[model samples]
Target: METFAEVLIILVVLTNLKLLGSSRATACIRTVAAQGVLLAALPLVTSGDAITLRMIAQALVSGTLKAFVLPFLLLRATRGARAGRELAPFVGYTTSILLGVALMPLALALGRKLGVTGPAGADLLAPAALFTLLVGLLIIVCRKQAVTLVVGYLAMENGIYAMGLAFAQREPLLVEMGILLDVFAAVFVMGLVARHIHREFDTLDTDRLSSLKG
Candidate 1:
């Protein structure tokens, strides 16, 4: 169980780095989807047998929504947006990767100082979660593309979901489901807005939106 959890954490961290470095919208969306899939498996790995039939069903629902449903929407939006990549980011890819590398140690140290309560491999969870969260924030702040912002937002939510599992494994099923639903709705709305931007301006670059006077 510990080993499995550790592997998942590592994958999540690697995915975060991949996201930071990626400029292609399609690749970024795919990485976020992979992150969601890993997050879904986290519960089973961290909590040995607290798994009820309901829990299993819940996992399937959350996983399917994050991994498939949401990405499909974003991809559909992208097709209409007609943008292939984030051509210019406020922070360059190299700098973003450097920041991610630096942030990892800080996250690990902070996690240790904060004294996270969980099992053996759980220590890794906090750092990985924090690292991913920061990476996501970086994406949101640095990228100019609307689609990239959506992807980054999902990445942040993924980090939050993973940390929630690590810290509150026994949280009620309803509460977990609620979080997933809220995220689903938020993503849905964001996709619509992205599509609207494309329709209105024929471009998905957020940089252009700033030219609006109102």
Candidate 2:
């Protein structure tokens, strides 16, 4: 089980890097969708004797929203905006990957110091969760486009959700539901803003949104 979670975490992190480096908006969106699906599967893969009805419900809701609904919304937004090329990254692709590599050790050290325990068979979840969180933060900081930024945000949220599954003893269904609702609302607003950006600037590049500079 630990190995499974580790594999999923690695896949998630790789997808984050792909999103950061890819020039095609469509490709980035697809990678985000894939990350969502992998995250959704984590619960089932790590389930042990402690599994409960509430946990299952939480996982279902999370998987449905993060994996299916959120991606569907983003895909629609991408199609509507007709965003093609990725804008210039604040940090280049190679630099971002290097930074990610540098950050991994810090994440591992933090997880080790914290010594978070997961299910009986799944002990590696802590370090993987920490790494995913760090990667998500890097994506948010380095990507300029609104869609890409949202993807980063979602990645971060997924990391948190993964941690909750790994560590939280009790299922916080209400909190989980609230977070999903907030994410949905945020995605709706972002889609509107993306449409407006395309309408006003003729591009989705964040660098190009500085027309009001003093």
Candidate 3:
């Protein structure tokens, strides 16, 4: 179980890097979908022979929503937005990758400071969760694309979900489901806004929206 946790953590970290480096919005969304899938598997890996029906349901619901439903909405929005890749990001791709690399060490230090040993006390798990959360924040702060922002939020939520497991905190199934639905609602609204931007301006760049004034 511990070994599986370590491996899953490494994979999640790699996906974060992938998200940071990729400019194609579709590719970025796909990367986020992969994160959702990995997060869904986390419960089973950490169950440690105590897996229950609730755990299975949570994993299933998380996988269905995060991996499938949400990404589908984002992809549909991206199509409507008619933008292929991020351009004129506040942070360049190279710089974003550097920040991602730097975040891992900082996350490690933070985990140590918090004395988070992780489930089964695995040293890498907690820090990796923090690293993922930071990477998502980096995406949100650095990119101007609306779809990218949604992807970043998903990544951040993924990190938070992972953190709960890393710190051995399990949320009730209803609470988790509600959080997922909230994200879904937010993304649906954001998707509509992105499409509106495209319809009004023929582009999905938020920086351009600054033209809206009193």
Candidate 4:
């Protein structure tokens, strides 16, 4: 169980780097979906031998939304907007990757310093979660596309969900459900706004929004 948790955490960390380095919007979306699948498995590993039906339900919901439903929504939004790769970013792709690499150690150090503990099988969850959050924030700040920002938001939510899974046995099921619902609503609203922005500007690039201030 510990090995499974460690592998999942490592995969999550790699996805974070992939998100930072990827320029193609489709690729970024896929990475986020992959992360979702990984996060969904956390409940099983974290639960160890005491897995419950409620945990299974949560994992199913999380995987479906983060892996399939949310990505489908973003893909539809992307097609409507005619957006693909970001092309150019506020931070270059290579630099962004390097930054992510730098952030890994920092996240670990921070996690250790904070002494945030997790369930038996999820010891590495805190650092992995922190790294994912930072990567998502980087995507939001450094990328220019509205779709990319949406993906970043999802990634950030994944991180939060991962942290929750680390302590799954203690957290209430209702709280997790609420968080999932809120995320769905947020993505729905953001997708609509992104579609509108594309229609109005004829582009999904958010940098173009600066011209609207006149």
Give residue 60's error in model 1 in angstroms. 0.8
Worst 10 residues of 2 by lDDT: 164-173
Q: Show where candidate 3 strays beyond 4 Å.
A: 212-214
lDDT of 3 by residue, 37-131 (tens): 89788878876888888888888888888788888888888885667888789999999999899888899899678877666636787788888
Pairs in clash, predicted candidate 1 = none
- Please give, for residues 82-136, the per-residue lDDT of candidate 4 as tens digits: 5877778899999999999999999899777756678776778988988898889
RMSD of each: 1.7, 2.2, 1.6, 1.6
Candidate 2 versus the native: TM-score?
0.87
**What is the TM-score of each predicted model, taking all chains together?**
0.93, 0.87, 0.94, 0.94
User: Residue 169 CA error for candidate 3 (Å)?
Assistant: 1.9
TM-score of 4: 0.94
The segments of candidate 1 whose C-alpha lies over 4 angstroms from its true place after superposition are: 212-214
- Please estimate how well model 3 matches the true structure, expressed as its whole-model Cα lDDT: 0.85
lDDT score, candidate 2, position 23 = 71
